[model samples]
Target: MNANQTQINSLSAQSNPTPIVGIIGGGVAGATTALHLSEQGYNVVLVEKNDSLVSGPPICHLHAGGNLYREISDEQCIELLKDSIESVKLYPHTINRRPTVIATPNHDQHDPQSLFPRLLQVQQHYKQLIDLDPSNKVLGEPDDYFKVFTKQQLLALKEQQQPAHPTTIEQWLIPFAQQVDLDTLRYPVVTVQEYGWSVFRLSAQAELSLSLESKCQLQLSSKVTNIEFNPHQAKPWAVSIHSQGQTQQLQVDYLINACGFRSGSLDNLANIKRTRLVEFKAAYVANWDDNQLLWPEVIFHGQRGTPQGMAQLTPYGKHVYQLHGMTEDITLFKNGLVISDNDSQPKLPTPLLNKIDIGWSEEVVAQRTQSAISHIAQYIPSFNSASLGGKPLYGAQQIPGDDVSLRATSVWFGEQNYACIETVKASSCLPAAIKIAQQLKLTGLEPSHRSSAAEESSNKALTESDIEQYAVRLARRRGYPEALALYYGQ
Candidate 1:
């Protein structure tokens, strides 16, 4: 093994253990969730089909701190995100404190100051839990003198977050990239959180699946083939998991079907088809080379609609970027959840769904790959010398796959059986993990091991119940900035 691989192996060895929790996937979400749950005192056993998920190329751009900070008002989602961010910030063995473009004048985007108000607040929240503080700041000059999240601004940021770094093919983005802080990001520009991150599922359901794996177990390859809820006992659900050619049945209390996009198959878990789950295929690429330029940046490709029809990009590790766009016009995080192979679903609006998946097109891929290079080239005009043979990037993988990924998924979370979806990006994992730990505290069923009286209060952080409102409020119901009414939207 090379020196770098040896180092990574050592780190993974230090992260193994079995808590009372059994995560279903081992991607980013599962990994972060496992770390948080383990820290919270649960003897977590991260079961995955594969031993090491760090192989191939790493996912890029941790979540954007600014993007994550926007949902802080939603208590449950906030804690989970906070915990995930803290893990990376306080590792004490890595480089961080990256900056990112905070906001724009357009709608659908989040303005930094409007989002966090004070950068110090995030760091302070972290210190209360872990002894570490992360420096997350926004950089850039806006045409407007002030701050606020505009739909257009969000679109601009999202647009920038995806589509390979532009500097490789062009040398102009360097100056543009310089204005943004890379350290403050949750991950590279195109990077996915790996947990609780939805590429193809409703935000809530995706979290349930990815969190269990990345957060509960350290395994990314865990996939559930069958699940049955036993009514005989309270909090009764027996889930049959299939991984690496092995199948095992396990019972869960408060069995959460956070099974990503495929969660619709969880009908047995609820004794009925509570919601239909749908699936879409996505892929990504990553690379690590000091010679790499076009500093990585995370991009949410969709200028419109939810993830079902959107694509994403992120930079990871030293220089890893990814793209996850689907065909068949599906919403990875919303409408897609309301339909399944077995369920007769409604025809989604073309605006909300599209058949033009960015992937599946070699021409598009080459164009995007070139765009990624140009993005880097713009950021660092001198990056060409650093470029390795044929660009340093591996093939592509699913966004938070289950069995090893969360299976880009969606969920049904409305009273009348409507698709009340939410988009929880890859960066949200840390905060979600923290929220789960706090939940355990309230129930007094703290994970097998952790408790910090100073910062242990289940009531304050977040709970699963609250997300229903959050989804409809921010995503489905309310209009951007205002014109919306939702106790959950706040």
Candidate 2:
């Protein structure tokens, strides 16, 4: 046997083969942690109640700089930029290389220039990252990170024919310029190198990669019934899970809660009290086949939770577009944002939980989707013709605290070897995993001979065609259009 294998076998002979890490939830956060831990020579048991991974929340935008939220701090934006770059590096195939347009309506008080200072700071940070490693140029040239276009410029480009394939940022803006009402917009609209993220494609990569890793035991369609903490034992956490109509127990050295919004539920089971907020949100799907022009993800910014809240239109291939209006009647429902009080788990109202556990009613889906279409039509008048494309991409996300405006977060270490990942955005998953790995090292539980499993798995021979086929199948399985799987401008 090889020296590394001999060392591993010797370790196994001592009754401590490798640390078994039990990760609850198969969302992006959990999958990422499992992948990283397994790569580091830990046996990972990833338990998810769903049949597929990354089947939670609608993640359309990469949030490269937290550009969608105007109210968030610049520090948060910079962190987002860093995290997003790392995510793109890990899952390069999932990114849709398209710029996003951030426009301010005339009714909004904030000017487009108000965003320039923060944008400039983000740009500089991006440039530094590229300097550190040229491969960090995922967002495109840092010099062209953001561009400003006045109403005159947009009007001038309104008549320009949309390119069959958009190479320049301006070409990507032609579709929006033609359809959007220029009079209602502010003087300048900012186009950033923020790209689109395909959750289905990300799911495909994670699922396929984890399947190939023998160290990771991905338990899909498995529900964690209970968890017991025995700090004195070699395996501190005893996780009882139900899968395939059978109940089984798994003894794990480390327990990671990456359950997204339901993370607090596991904390409650362990009797760990934590203050958190859970918000249920959904984005609608609409098909605009009438217009063949490709468009960048467009954002018409406004105050949150108001009638004229932020409106986002994300274009998927095959003329399918996802829509989000951050108003009470649309994406944000009544009592959608709930906080943990006496218990760690915030109790979402029964009806909302039903929509989560069960599925949303067809009537509700039609109503909300139609509302979203009309909301987008206010900005892009021609969008009124867009019809409901598929079921809404929806889920609940947990915020670390009550700060609803918080966009970027990482891992939080609790008692013992237990860690809870608070990933507000998909990009935060990688950093969270890295932090958890660091924590594991501090415990001195990391194996002596670090396996190259994760590195090898990450560099596995997979072509773009492989990803497209798997992503399309995943999307269709999840009741979404195949278009949602295909990257725009690919």
lDDT of each: 0.35, 0.88
**For model 1, how does the per-residue alpha-carbon lDDT over 1-490 read when each residue is reduced to its tens digit?**
4332233234334534322454444444554555556555565544443343322222333342334233334343334435345534422112122222332222234433343333344334434444342242121111111223333333345334323334221122232344433332322132211221222112322233334332234434555676554558433445565654656555444333333332343443344444232333223342435434333233332233332223333333345334444323321323432333343222233432333211134454455444444433332344332322122222122222122223222222322111211113344545555655555555545444334642233222334444334433433321111111111100
Give the Cα error of residue 353 in candidate 2, in Å.
0.8
Residue 124 error, candidate 1, Å: 11
- The alpha-carbon lDDT assigned to residue 28 of candidate 2 equals 96
Model 2, position 459, has a per-residue lDDT of 29
Error of 2 at 424 (Å): 0.7
Q: Provide TM-scores for the models.
A: 0.45, 0.95
Predicted candidate 2 versus true structure: per-residue lDDT over 455-478, tens digit per residue = 575426556777888999999888
